[model samples]
Target: MKLKTYDISLVGMFAALMAIGANITSVAPFLQVAGVPLSMQPFFCILAGLLIGSRLGALSMIVYALIGIAGAPVFAGFSGGPGVIIGSTGGFILSYIVAAYVAGRIVERSQNPGLPSFYTASFAGIVLIYVIGTTYMYAALNFWMEVEMTYLGAWGIMSWFIVKDAAFTVLGAVIAPRIYKSVHRGARLGRRSAA
Candidate 1:
């Protein structure tokens, strides 16, 4: 029997959705400081981008957000509906699209010279996600809630979110390359057997 090769786009989409779901499940309690409560959930977004590449990563995030908005309980804490998107966390949610796109593109472009290159690319993607996600959160809270936040306060919030994401990114960076190599090897083996 001839083995079928999966479409790259489909693989990307499935991976993206799975990453998003992983992110939704990984959320913990919100970090509150000076009455500004922020959920730490950007790691999943970064992971999606790093694994899936820019376009599919962004598309996956958008799809997940849209699904939540359409009343699916696919978001953190099983929360769903349009209210979540329009809440204080909305900007962060929206930022995932930007973060994922930027990260994914960086990862895709850095896919050479083996595992070190992949890890470097993943790190770049992580940085991109944090920058975009934190900036969006700061702006959203400042504008919508009229919070008087100092630079330190903003940094504090950024730090809170960034640490978690960075940890996850590091973990992904370590494991993903091995998984990719294994899959490629398996595919090649299957093809040889078929021949």
Candidate 2:
């Protein structure tokens, strides 16, 4: 499907927002819960999905990934480059596209994109991200990086992030519908004024 200029802008905005989210660490840097740094990207990913739907949401994430790989320091800890994309945490970064797509697809399919829909989609999407991320992490570390980590070990590491991700999921679910409505309403008004 072809995107209008406004949709394209929204996609770009989400991509930038994803980058900004990665850089924000207001909740104390030294806070260590199973060696995972808390991040806001999960919330932004779900917001993108809910606002833009599957295709645009996924496209936004892809753009974000490209920017980070291009050395924009958009990734977590302000790290970026091809090396980062191929690194151990790369799986989680890459999974953002799939996760957003899944969440957006679910919301798009729902007749009423309300709290229940958002909650379900967010939860499922987060789970999918973990699944894809954990599997890729295991393979990348053990085979590619030669770091040697069992599948369970990789999952164990991810278990720590699950709670943090869940919190973001809830935030996304609560705020997404409102933002989606406001954005679309503004789009409609713009179209009307132009017409």
- Candidate of highest TM-score: 2
Using lDDT as the measure, which candidate wins? 2
Candidate 1 residue spans exceeding 4 A from truth = 1-41, 111-113, 182-195
On the 0 to 100 scale, the lDDT of residue 142 in model 2 is 89
lDDT of 2: 0.85
Task: Put down candidate 2 lDDT per residue, 73-186, tens digits, no spaces.
Answer: 888888899998788879888989998999999999998789999999899889888888889889889888989888989888877788888987898899888888888787
Show where candidate 2 strays beyond 4 Å.
26-35, 192-195
Query: lDDT of all the models against the reference?
Result: 0.62, 0.85
lDDT of 1 by residue, 73-112 (tens): 7666667898876665566667778877876676567636
Global Cα lDDT for candidate 1? 0.62
Q: What is the TM-score of candidate 2?
A: 0.90
